[model samples]
Target: MQQREEKQLESALDSLIQRVNDLKSSIAAMIFKVENEYETLNWPQFLDNFALLSGHLTSLSKLLNHDKCPPLRNLTVLPLNLSPERDEQLAQLTEGRVTTFAHDLVPDYLRTKLEPMAESKMLHFEQKAATVTYENAQKQVAAYQKVVSNIWDIVSKTREEWEVESSSRGNTQQHSSVSDTHLLVTAIGMGKGLKPNPNANGAPGQPTGGMMVPPQGRPGSAGQGPIPPSTQTMTMNKTPSTIKTNIKSATQIHPYNR
Candidate 1:
């Protein structure tokens, strides 16, 4: 039973080492494809490499977590004696002093085992994220306000212009109505042989009640009253020769008769 357990342990270690090596090779291949063959790299091949690396990592994790596997925390590094030739080769490659223990080459901080400060890091991250969110929210609010302000300005300007146009149209219509009324009054006055009173208190060109004046040149009618329809018709029918003879007689005797 002891021998079987030892064999299982050896097999588990070999499988774990093999999985690690596969993962390393996959990572190296992917890095090479990116650095050297980027122009000709195939996406399908890159994805396959990534999948293979993930599989290797999964297998390694399963091996480490298996009941037969020993705890990794209890493992210790064992120093090995290196041949002089190997030591010389390592010294040449590193270009520094060589040591048997790998930890001796690392900085003290890096070599020390550290417990994670999860709570502090999480709090700091939350604060930073909240700050960023607030800044973005403030920016969005300012932008929205600016847009709203611009829209309000446009609406106000449009309303003002509309009001001005409405007023202008109203004034034009009023003026046209007044002109039409004046024309009608003037036509009525002409048809009735009447004229607008010059001394009326109303607006110019408008009629005043009972203040209209009669037209000139009618028999038996004075400037104070309108001519009768019969008199107006008789005056209109008079010949030019008769009017000239009357005018000549009147002019000849006007001064002495007066």
Candidate 2:
């Protein structure tokens, strides 16, 4: 009975192995198509590969659940006693001084217990990273908005100042122009009755109206006695006629009097 049971178990295990190999082959083919033949692969070929893989997986699942199958458990790995030549070849391939399957070749982590808190720590780190990135993005946006607002304010203030300065300058110019015009009008009005001095010396080539008159006295008398009343009256009356005669002669000689 023990031998028969072993045979049945072996058959079941063989079937499971065959199904797993089929699944592995189907996966490898799919990976090859994706990696190298993706451009040439059609929907039908992809669906066929998927269906084959799914069927193999279903078979493997059924076999694993079968009564004849043993319970899944950790199995001890025992190193094969390879020949010396084969051991040397494996050592050369791995670039190690010892055999590939030596007890010391196992990693320390595989021999130690897994820490339950490691997964939680990794999750916490990822969450913190995501939060930091989001906060940085928000800060950048706020800074950008502030800079834009400042630029807008500066532009608006500059425009307002320019307008105000331009208006003030225009008003000042207008006031100056009006004041100048008023001064010009006042000068014209005040100078209406004013004339050039006729007694002033004339420029070269111009005639003058002035003339020199002789003093009322004897030609050779320097200290003569006082004249009689009748003589003085006659001299005074004759002076106006003599002065008139000289002015008339000067006017006739001047070029402008013609």
Candidate 3:
């Protein structure tokens, strides 16, 4: 009975390792070209990128399913390059201070132990994920916040243009602030209605209602709504404060191609 179990573990591990190798090659071939590209793109490019990522992840799932067996076969044939000195090298890399105990430490330990170890690892990951509760709506509602954040890459300032304005405030030199360009802008808005006060940092000029103006000189003008931030920006601000959420009726579409 013990011998049979060892054989089963060996076979399973062999299948999994082979499957992982196959998947690595497929993923390399599929993704080697994403770096090369042409002109500007629209949302379709994002969809394409998502599709590509999904494909690779699927390959990963296939690999995981295909190879989830224990290294029971030869048991002597290790997963990585093996030499007399390889064990010491591995221990150094892991910093785990691994030492080879008697393979006979458990009467037939190979047939009885490693499989349960792998199963335990699987359970551990699942329990960790449960702690996050990312899918629970109530937990998500609690996640709403009071402040928002945005990231920016390039900031291009417009050439300063001088102009004179004849307003009730007299002949004051009103430089067209629009000409002074910038890389990015950020602002906040909160209101139960649409009237605007230009002086308010949150106001977006004269708009229909609740308005959000990116601070000072943003890529687009005021009340343009939100722009899907750049990927780098997402990484920089993964956990950000959320404010003025659940106001979907006030959402406006941006005109420029994202």
Question: Candidate 2, residue 207: CA error in Å?
Answer: 99
Task: Residues 1-258, candidate 1: write the lDDT tens digits.
Answer: 879866876787788777877887889888998999989888998898889888888888888998888765665544454233336556664454553324444333233353367667888888987777777989989999999999999999999999999989887743357777887787676644355565567654444754544565545545545556676577777877698889999988887765
| Deviation from native of the Cα of residue 156 in model 3, angstroms | 34
Off by over 4 Å in 2: 1-5, 74-99, 104-258
- Which whole-number lDDT from 0 to 100 does residue 51 have in model 1? 90
Candidate 2 clashes between residue pairs 3 or more apart in a chain or in different chains: none
Tens-digit lDDT track of model 3 for 39-151: 45456865766676677667656645554444333356323332333366546643544433334422333354456679899899888877876577466555543112111
lDDT of each: 0.71, 0.72, 0.50
Cα error of candidate 3 at position 236, Å: 94
Can you tell me which runs of candidate 1 are displaced by over 4 Å? 1-10, 78-103, 106-258
- On TM-score, the leading prediction is 1
Q: TM-score for every candidate vs. truth? A: 0.35, 0.33, 0.24
Q: How do the candidates rank by lDDT, highest first?
A: 2, 1, 3
Q: Could you tell which candidate, 1 or 2, scores higher by TM-score?
A: 1
